[model samples]
Target: MIHGSVVHDPTGSWDTKAPLDRDAHTALATAVLHWDQHTAPAPAPADVEQTALLLSGYLDRLARELHAALETLPHGQLPVRDHVAAEIALSQVRRWLDGPSGAFQGEPLAQAQSAARLVDTLHHAVDRTLGAHPPTAT
Candidate 1:
């Protein structure tokens, strides 16, 4: 069943709750599966440019949220090693955004790549902070 199902609650009490970590993992996995099935290659230049503008705004919001989450980690609780790993991942993300790989690609490709890198960084940080496995390689 999907994470939220009316049938699961027969009592009609609408007692819904947000997903916990495991549920989140499952949902993300399902989403990736669906995306893989449905997504096609990058679109034409006009569409790409329009999409890029929107994607850039979304990425900015995501970056802010990531920064906030990073701040919430307890000082001693966040291991130096994990921080270093996150730093490395973030650097890779930046490189992807700034390097030659970003130049020739259509705007859609560029945007998608940028978003993927951010997701990678986010996953790494979340795994490190929660002491959980790096989420099942979606």
Candidate 2:
């Protein structure tokens, strides 16, 4: 049984075929939420490290999925706007990776805020990407 949230077609107005976009958006939203939850505070150093590692893995997976989706698109069919949004999302993840450990080396409040911002950025990008590609019947 398919037990999960169902995303409506993005291009329903135009009656385009957009199964891939729907699936991608759903997956991206899931990842963003997972990161947000794990990144919250009150953990030991070891636990924080583990959480970071997991988030890194998730980011890597997302990158691979985005790349594959981009690869599958034909030149004309490629959603340039979506690609740009995804790129921004990827850049935000990279920033967190490169950001100083000290930046998150404060109280749980600060850490949670930073993490939340990152997750929000990711969600925004995913939403933009999903909206950028209208469903196309191909």
Candidate 3:
């Protein structure tokens, strides 16, 4: 009798579908919360610094993942708007990460908050863009 292959790999080559790392997601929430001006008992300097570092690392990783996805997709598969949005979001994160003590200068928390928002935006934009181009049937 004919039989299917031993296993199915429904994902990127060696990458599969890389979900946002749990630690990064948690850092995102923490960064956003601590950076909020309304949050009582403001975060300590170390907390803010740590969050910023995590955010920077996540931004770097997320941007690369998004780029790989875009590169691998078939041309014209993703909507123009969605593609542009993802690019813009990526730019937002990349710009911040690249800048050494950007405009937020004396405000790392503010920077971290911005990074969190940018990363979140990039994450959603990539999801939307990729979702536009669903995987082909096996």
Please give each candidate's TM-score: 0.43, 0.44, 0.72
Name the 10 consecutive residues with the lowest summed lDDT in model 2: 11-20
Model 3's TM-score against the true structure: 0.72
Name the best candidate (by lDDT).
3
How do the residues 1-138 of candidate 1 rate in per-residue lDDT, one tens digit apiece? 569443655542342232234344334333333333136644465655554444443333344344555676667666688877766665654554466766236545455445544554656565675562223465
Per-residue lDDT of model 2, residues 56-136, tens digit only: 544444544454455555555546666777777777776665677733465543344455455556655555554445587
List residue ranges in candidate 3 displaced over 4 A.
1-19, 22-27, 34-39, 100-104, 136-138
Error of 3 at 60 (Å): 0.8
lDDT of each: 0.49, 0.52, 0.71
**Candidate 3, clashing residue pairs?**
12-16
Cα deviation of 60, candidate 2, in Å: 0.9
lDDT of each residue in 54-86, candidate 3, tens digit only: 777667777877887888878898888888888
